[model samples]
Target: MNLREQISHYIPYTTQETKEQEVILKYMDTFDNLLARENESAHFTASAWVVNPERTKVLMAYHNIYQSWSWVGGHADGDPDLLQVALKETKEETGLTTISPVTENIYSVEILGVPGHLKKGIPIATHLHLNVTYLIEANEEEKTTVKEDENSAIKWMELEEAIEACTEPDMKVVYRKLNDKLKNYK
Candidate 1:
């Protein structure tokens, strides 16, 4: 199945709370300005936090290009909507069918300009991500296959374990924020 299909199959669309929508809208506005300022080649991306309630483990992908362990996510490409970008990236990287955000508690992160493509050594303009970490409850039966192009491997890791495993400080911050958010959720 294609990325869109895969997302629809695995994740359900949960309604966004008023505050969440407001934050998302603000991000979208900022993204619009960023796109205009940056080159057309620049892209937007999104990711999801797939969790297993029974094990309290979260799904993560080993990004081959970056050589880092991170939550499944990717670029928005031409899609103007950041949420769609996140949904598409999550499905493409994880091969999960259905996913959605956790409604009232979405997180927005602004990653300043970082190294572009690792192999090519190209420089990319700074981009903003209005990330909404979805607390996805998935069964073992649902995670079928992962895309080899984006991710080398996919696995479920305990929140603390995953946080410790991540080498990048930024990624660690994201993980911790998500973990704290998950506490209120439980």
Candidate 2:
């Protein structure tokens, strides 16, 4: 089995009861299966949850394509370890090299489907994001520089507003889980 098949073997498909189960199932059955057949184009990626020291806020980026506020992350490219992928993507997107987990707490996986490319007008294959979110604490002196190519803007926002601003419901779930995990630290 190839890398894509290996990864897909571990990822669970959305069950029948899931709200988007049909869509996910169809994609998993079709797009993902086909992508698994292609050796050259398969990809895996990760993302991070860069929370502030106060615990009341988290860093987010205004995605250019989606035009919505979202967390900092990008494609893992060749990084085999998903955790390292998350860390690397977070650093690349947010320019925070010293960021580390607040309590060594890692969170769940989030899956998302990549829409068709705007310029190419070709349907992009489904992407399974084995996201391992971390509660990172950074010093006040650490300067933040948003990578403009990846994100239009970046800022620290109140957790509540961050959750509300997220367009994806699964991301909202991620925020809630992160919030719950941080409660013990308070």
Candidate 3:
């Protein structure tokens, strides 16, 4: 299904997601280039909320740009398949050879505000990420290596530590919501 159809059919888990879902749908209708970063103002992004088999810990990377522990994700770069984007990013960012989705359906959705930051020494303006998150499972036995260009470290953090380690206030809310949803999966 197309991104619009996918988002349209998603049953939101919270009032926040319900509101963000509406905004994302409007953005999808308003801009055709949102699938790529070329859109400037807002674009589609995919996130992997990697968890261990027991669902007790989350695999997170210390983001170089945000200077905080964060989930693995990236811009769609013209791909409509966010789940594939999430999987590809999980491998590239974490160096995990084994990864699988807990469910093929989107696990969460958010319209995230990204502050302007320098990437590879070049300035990037602030923008919105119409983010889609998927629950992914990985073996804790597989070693994780950081993609130095993007993150400084990659580790499996307890769910609470994962939330507490994040410095972004907005992201804390997102993380909390994600963690809360884990109860439903069990």
Candidate 4:
């Protein structure tokens, strides 16, 4: 099946999130593109929370745009392989070559409103991420590098600490739910 179809088929673990994802899926006609920016509107995005093997810590970046510590991820940019997009962004952003999924199932999904920010020196208006999240594992003892263009810092944080580091108002709810699910996962 295609990536959009795969997202449509994904069953979120929570009824509320499932409903939110269904709503986002209904917006897929505009979401299925790199140009889906819709004049400061929503677009499809793929992201991940990279955890340690023991699942106690998560890898996060201090996002330049959001100006807060956030999960590792990026835009789908017309790429239908969102799962691959998540994995690829993790590798590119964190320089981790061995990240692997905790499960093939989706870790979470949301329709996130992104505040307007500058990208590539251009001002981007506020937008939405018809966002999908995944849980992946990476080695903490392994080295990491900052993708300076995107983030100022990248490091391994205790899962609780990561949870606390989420400063985005809407993302706090998403993080809490994601944390609860992660606990149930392993």
**Highest-TM-score candidate:** 3
Q: RMSD, model 4, all Cα superposed? A: 2.0
Question: What is the per-residue lDDT of model 3 for residues 96-181, given as tens digits with 9 covering 90 to 100?
Answer: 98999998899999999989988998899999999999999999999889999999999899999999999999999999999999
> What local lDDT does model 3 show for residue 96?
98
lDDT tens per residue, model 2, 11-81: 23223113333333344455542222242233344567777777778888887767778987666555545
Worst 10 residues of 1 by lDDT: 6-15
Best by lDDT: 3
What is the number of backbone collisions in each predicted candidate, taken in the order shown? 9, 0, 0, 0
- Model 3's TM-score against the true structure: 0.98
Q: 143-182 in candidate 1: lDDT tens per residue?
A: 5466877778888788898888788787787687667657
Is 3 or 4 the stronger prediction by lDDT?
3
Off by over 4 Å in 4: 29-40
Clash pairs, model 3 backbone: none
lDDT of 4 by residue, 1-186 (tens): 776677778878788887987787678665445424543577778899899998888898998877889998888776777778899999989888988988766778888887777789898887778788988989999888889998888989887788788788777788878878888885
Clashes of 4: 0
Locate the minimum summed-lDDT window of 10 residues in model 3.
Answer: 177-186
Candidate 3, residue 114: the lDDT equals 88
Candidate 4 TM-score, C-alpha based: 0.90
Off by over 4 Å in 3: none
